[model samples]
Target: MNITIERAALLRSLGHVQSVVERRNTIPILSNVLLRAGDGELSLAATDMDLEIVETVPATVGRPGGTTAPAHTLFDIVRKLPDGSQVELDIGGDGTILTLRSGRSQFKLSCLPVEDFPQLSSGELKHNFSVAAADLRGLIDRTRFAISTEETRYYLNGIYLHAAKSKMGSLETPVLRAVATDGHRLARVEMPLPDGADAIPGVIIPRKTVTEIRKLVDEAADRIELSLSDNKIRFGFDSVVVTSKLIDGTFPDYERVIPVGNDKVMEVDAKLFAAAVDRVATISTEKSRAVKLSLVRGALTLSATSPESGSATEELEVNYAESPLEIGFNSRYLLDITQQIEGEGAQFTLADAASPTIIRDVADSTALYVLMPMRV
Candidate 1:
């Protein structure tokens, strides 16, 4: 295949596809990206068996054919090339080498037959919907931080996405919720359900897929098209399509973990709370990093102590009118949940020191967090 593509366009497309190619691969073909030139466009595809990304960029095609080249190597070459240079790619006479020419630089890259590349099956998707890019991005950012990294309990290694009835104001409304937990802290965010999404199946979107889709939606204002099957999900937008396999495990019922009827309530500035936690945590031991919260009439005290290091205590004014309560929590976990609060103050409902605590954003009823307390 022979094609002439502007360096800027080619570089952008390569940036999207090459990320799927792993640095080390057991299969040689998995390290290569398939490139096809036809119909005034160049198509780039890369896959690592579990995830596949395809993108198309406008180009001037001299020959209509396809080949596979090292994804990372080609990306590096294009990235280092002079801006605005027209890159020309042509298959050698032997059909085993791809010659790349731009400006005065020329390079011959080893090629593999496009037929040898594995293509992810696009099964009949049972659900398809379009959601605003901002909403989709918010769902990912608010919950992904809580995804578990442990491999043993693979079910908790992803974000649980489903449609549920939620109180959006005073009336019950359909909403899409993303929930993630690591047995220590949980994050849940909801957005208005999209059209044609009523029949969508609840699935666990792998952490990697969430990360990739987040990058795609950054700074994008257009709606993203989403398609889902029993085992796979696809996100399409801006001439790019990302398909990923769903985690084949059942996510634990999260509702039971959320605390209910917790009468002790406290409201504190989100930023102030996080900063106090951070400051007091400095004296905490590396292993525990535990911070203790002491609440009384109208003040909250954050303190941390380590036998070897030192101790710290910080007081902050809050709106709490409950009996005295002392709770110990991992400082990192507290900071993580507090950072997710977009409102001025974070509201916390507590039953006791041992029971889980419920946290919410004062301005957004659609998001909530549950954090399990620790022993100080």
Candidate 2:
């Protein structure tokens, strides 16, 4: 196979495919990317068994054939090449080596049979829908931070996506919601449901798939096409398609964890709240990193203490008319929720010091967060 592709175009496609290739692999073919040249384009594909990414880039094809080459090595070579250089790839008659030439540099890379590369099965997807890039991106960015990293509770290691009836400006509306939690904090964000999405089955998108799709959506100009089955999901946009296996576990009942009748309410500047938590957390012990919030009639005090280090205290004016309440929380968890608030202030509803607290953006009703308080 022989093909000539611009360095910039090749690098862009490589950047998308190579990331799915693990640096260390038990199977030799898994370490290589399948390259197929035909019809004035080059298709590059890489897979890690659970996830597969395929990208097509326009090129001048001299010979139509397919081969596999080291994904990372090829990416590095193209990345270091001079800008606007035309990259030429040729597979030998024996199909054992690939010769890459650009400018004055030439390199021979070991090749593998493309037939050995594993392919992701395109199952019969029961649900198909389209979502704007920005809407999908927003849903992911708002909830992914709360995805659990623990391997034992694999069910909590992804975002729960489903269609539900939610309140949209006092009217019941069908909305697509994303929820993620790590037992410490939870994030829930909802977007208007697209047409034909009502039949979409609920699926837990793994953390890795969420991250990869985010990257693809960032570079995509057209609406993202989504197809989901019981065990897998696929995303297609532009010249790229990503398919991933879903986590085979059930997510917890998140609604029960959310506080319903919390009466005590307080509103504080989101940025100021995040900054105060950051400042007070400096004196907290590394193990705990706990910060205490003391709320009075119209003011809130943030304080942290460590037996070995020191202590810190900061005061912020807030709009609180409820009874006095003292709560302890992990500083990092508080910051994570506050950073997602894009409104003038963050509203917190509390039942007591031990009960979970509800947080919301003052201007956004579609997003809500719940954080479990920590012992200080």
Candidate 3:
């Protein structure tokens, strides 16, 4: 196949598709991207067996054919060439050596049989729905930080997405829910269920899929299409398609971990509170990393101490009329929840020094984070 494509357009798709390809592959053909030229466009497909990403870019086809070539090598060759340069790719359709030409640069890259490339098949997808691109993005960004990295609890290593009973109000019974946790902290967010997606299967989008979904979300688009079956999930938007295998293990019962009777509530500016915690954390012990929060009538004080380093202390004006309380939490967990707060004020609820603290944006009840308290 012979085709000419704009460097910028080709590079954009290659950058994403190649990221899904691993640097080392036990199967030699898996290291290459399957290129197929057809009706006015060329498609590039790459997969790491578990995650598959495919992109189609518009091209001027001289001869319609296909081949496979090293994705990273082709990416580098085009990346170093001048911007806006026209890249001409030609393949014999027999899946042998492929050729690349740009300006004065020329390359004959070794190719493998395109038939050897793995294809992600969408077989009888039970549910199909459309999600606002921004909403899809929010669902991942708000909870992904809490996803467990621990390999032993493999089920919790991804975000658990399902329909959940609404937490705040009486009228709204259930909403689409996304939850993530790593034992110490948990983040949960909700959005009104989309029309066609009501029967969507409860699925765990693995860590890898969560990452690739983030890239598609960054594009300035209004909506995205999602397809899901028992084991696989696929997302389609514009010229890109991303498909992945869902974790087969079951996620933990997250609702039990959510505290309901935390009576102490304190409101503080998110930006200021995060800044104070960051400063005090500098003096926290490397292993424990605890920061103590002491709340009095009208003010809150943050302090941390380490046997090897100096201590740090700071204060912030807060809105809390409850009795004084002292609590310690992992500084990193506290910062993560606060960073997601969009508005000026963040609401914190606590029952005791050892109880888990609940945090939420003062104006938005759709998102909430619960952090387990730690000893000082």
Which predicted model would earn the best lDDT?
2
Report the C-alpha lDDT of model 2 over 302-371, residue by residue, as the tens digit.
9999999888999999999999999999998899889989888899999998999999999999999999
Q: All candidates' TM-scores? A: 0.97, 0.98, 0.97
Q: Tens-digit lDDT track for model 3 on 77-99?
A: 88998998999998765558788
Candidate 2: segments with Cα more than 4 A from true spot: 168-170
lDDT of 2 at 94: 97
Evaluate residue 86 in candidate 3 and report its C-alpha lDDT on the 0 to 100 scale.
98
Q: How much lDDT does candidate 1 score? A: 0.92
- Worst 10-residue lDDT window for candidate 1 reads 212-221
Better of 1 and 2 by TM-score: 2
Q: List where candidate 1 sits over 4 angstroms from the true fold.
A: 168-170, 219-221
lDDT ranking from best candidate downward: 2, 1, 3
Model 3 steric clash pairs = 1-91
Q: Per-residue lDDT tens digits of candidate 1, residues 1-376?
A: 8999999999988998898889999899999999999999999999999899999999999999999999999999999999889999999686789999999999999999988998884676879999999889889989999999999999998999999999746989999889999999999899888888888889999988888888879835588989998799999888999999999999999999998779999999999899889999999999999999999999999999999988999999999998999999999888888988888989999999899999999988889999999998
lDDT of 2 at 110: 98
Clashes of each: 0, 0, 1
| Candidate 3 or 2, higher TM-score | 2
